[model samples]
Target: MTWKVLLPVGEATEVMDTLYPIFRLPEDGFEVVVAGPEPRLYHGVMHEIPPNENIPWDITREQPAYHVRATEAFRDIRPEEYAGLFLSGGRAPEYLRYDQDLLDITRHFFEAGKPVASVCHGVEIAAAAGCIQGRTMTTVAKCALDVTQFGGIYVDQPVVTDGNLVSARTWHDNTPFLKEFVRLLKASVAPK
Candidate 1:
């Protein structure tokens, strides 16, 4: 049977962070299902440091918008229906971490010991949901404290996998992170 994956959607979701898995997961035969606070189009953002000093340092990166729609809502999702879950990066997690429904969905994967992957600011959701305890992960350096504060070992690596959880610091690390995640998903789907 083909596996299903839950991808949480939100405003300002980092474009590369969200899109890489959206396309890659399906290549491995897992259906990527987007979910959000509501089942509708969510805006995506691009992040990159400016090479020109003409731009303000505080606004080092340029932000461009893209639209992504969610197929379902967290409150209505059945976590067991999916074989894996992927949490994406962006400023979205700063607010999404507070969402009770999202938190519940985040918890289900960890509690079930299912395949889970998170990148960049996505660590905030896992930390907020109390799923990072005793696990090791890597996120954008700024969020290193968030993971440690939540009792997770914060490593500064391109990819880190502990048990069924896999993480990457940023889009630059997506290649390795996605490779490991696909391996885990395939291993799970392999005949036991």
Candidate 2:
């Protein structure tokens, strides 16, 4: 059977955080379905602290990057049809968390015990959905508050795996994050 993974995204999504999985998932034989607030093209952004400058920047600087097309809207997502969920990092989650449909979809993945992976600000969406309560995870240091505020345990590490959920601090942690997430996905479909 072909397994499908749901990837929710929006404008300003971190390019590496969003695009790496888009291309990597297929290599493991999972069909990636990109969803957004609307079924349209959304702009992606790159976030990084510039090296050696007159004055150091405290946080990542966002710059417009690539364009990714969302084939489905958040309201149209059928969580039951997906084998897992992947939430990408970016400023987009700051607002995407406000969407009721997206929140509901996020809850479904947790409720069903499906494999779930989140990175950076992506934790905001899961936090908003109330799925992270009592769970331990990691995200961009700046977003650690989002987890603690929502009743989840925040860890300052590259990656954290709790049950079916796998989380990472940022795009830089994608290597370990995706490794564990893919392991969870493959295990979920293993013959009982």
Clash list (residue pairs), candidate 1: none
Candidate 1's C-alpha runs over 4 A off are: 55-62
lDDT of 1 by residue, 1-192 (tens): 778999997888988999999999999899999999999988898887666677556532748778888989889999989888899998888899999999998899999888999999999999999999999899988889999999999999999999999999999999999999999888866889
Q: Which candidate has the top score in TM-score?
A: 2
lDDT of 2: 0.95
- CA deviation > 4 Å runs, candidate 2: none
Cα error of candidate 1 at position 61, Å: 2.0
TM-scores vs. true structure, each candidate: 0.95, 0.98
List model 2 lDDT by residue over 1-192, tens digit each. 889999998999999999999999999999999999999999999999999979999999999999989999998988999999999998989999999999999999999999999999999999999999999999999998999999999999999999989999999998888999999999998889
